[model samples]
Target: MTGMSRCPAHTERAQTSLPALGIALVLLTVVTGLGVSMADAAIAGAERTPDERRVAAAIADRLVSADGPLAARSNVLNRSRVDDFDQSALERSAPPATEYAVSVEVADTEIASSGAVHSGTQITRLVVVEARESRTLTPDLTTTDTVTLPRRSAQATVTIDPPAGTTIWTVRANDRVVLHNRSGLDGSYEVPLIPYETTELRFQRAGSIQPGNVTVSYDAPRSTKESLVVTVDA
Candidate 1:
């Protein structure tokens, strides 16, 4: 060794005192923990702006209301409408959506968002989503010319397959003329009806008809409960 180099043990001891190193590391850990705790406390104490919370609540209320675009009844959302809901739909349904950053979700799936949201207020409401499912019914028209539907539907698919001698001239839904063919109605047709009341289809025919001659297919609404969440950032 040209310059009296220190041994490994001596070099290690000279680099730093064991007691001092231990104390420094312990103090560093304590300071870091304190800093983290203080940051958590500050964040917990910070609440969203009152206006943000109010707007969030309002948007949530409007989305679940009966007259809302996404809803079919009070707190009952239409699945078709919900699927079509977007930022434009949100702004149209709730005017406040245009002024603030708003996002709406159901069952954790985001349906509509107006703007970017980092952090703000959230309002949650319980709601039911109604989906229109196809259901078919073939009424027993062997003896009676009238048939009542079991469920209410907005429109029905009326399929006519009459025998050679039979001819259906007209069809009515509770006195409302749905189909009229002076020559003879011989094919399938879609008929619109009022969904608010029970429907009874009456057929006007000139020849004999039996069961399995007429069939009806309609969409019945099925509902499932879900949570509607609205978040607003201002």
Candidate 2:
């Protein structure tokens, strides 16, 4: 028996379908390429999250350190320097990677920023800021009978030893009377120091009493502590 011959019209239809098959293959390749690109972007974004967090933590730690550029003491920031901080300071303090943006906030208030911050990682730190004036008074009372304070102190604590058969009459700071008592006194007393150019403290006594073991103490202005937040975008 003779083998069945192929139909001429059917062969032409099969040949024409080859171009459609090729077009379908091209479309599949393009779709696959696009999907791969999207996947890579998502993976990169996920990887950057941890890296940005680490960078932000490191930067915040450095800023709050005693030896860092913006710190006066450990976890204490200089208010003037913090106010002056800007993009240039951020760049100088940050790592040498230019792919990230950084911003700083103290007590929920934005202080410094660099680059656009749409989305990224964040870190918060406890920091102290000395925005007010601070001073310490430790007079040279060891060598002298009287103590003088260099600055005008608002408050002072005086410690003294009363001599036998003597009564403490009055206390004077910078020649201005501050405390006066008729009874015999011994131990510590808190007194408000008068604001003067030179504040001097002396005890007035009766019955030939000599001052012994006297100390005057003054505390500096108080500092405030708050949260410091750092954000980084990659």
The TM-scores of all predictions, comma-separated, are 0.66, 0.49
Highest lDDT model number: 1
lDDT of 1 by residue, 1-234 (tens): 835576876878977797798899999999999999999877764644778889999889888888988888889889989999998989988999899999899989999998898877899999999898888878777788997864548899999989998899999999899999988898899999788788999999988887788998888878788999999988
For model 2, name the residue pairs that clash: none
| Residue 52, candidate 1: C-alpha displacement in angstroms | 1.9
* TM match of model 1 to true structure: 0.66
Q: Write the per-residue lDDT of candidate 2 for residues 171-231, one digit (tens) a residue.
A: 8886678777778567888878654465778766665534344556774444688999989
Each candidate's number of clashing pairs is 0, 0
Model 2 lDDT, full chain set: 0.75
lDDT of 1: 0.87
Query: Candidate 1 at residue 34, lDDT?
Result: 100
Model 2, C-alpha of 165: deviation from truth (Å): 27
CA RMSD per model (angstroms): 8.4, 11.4
- Candidate 1 residue 9 Cα shift, in angstroms, is 47
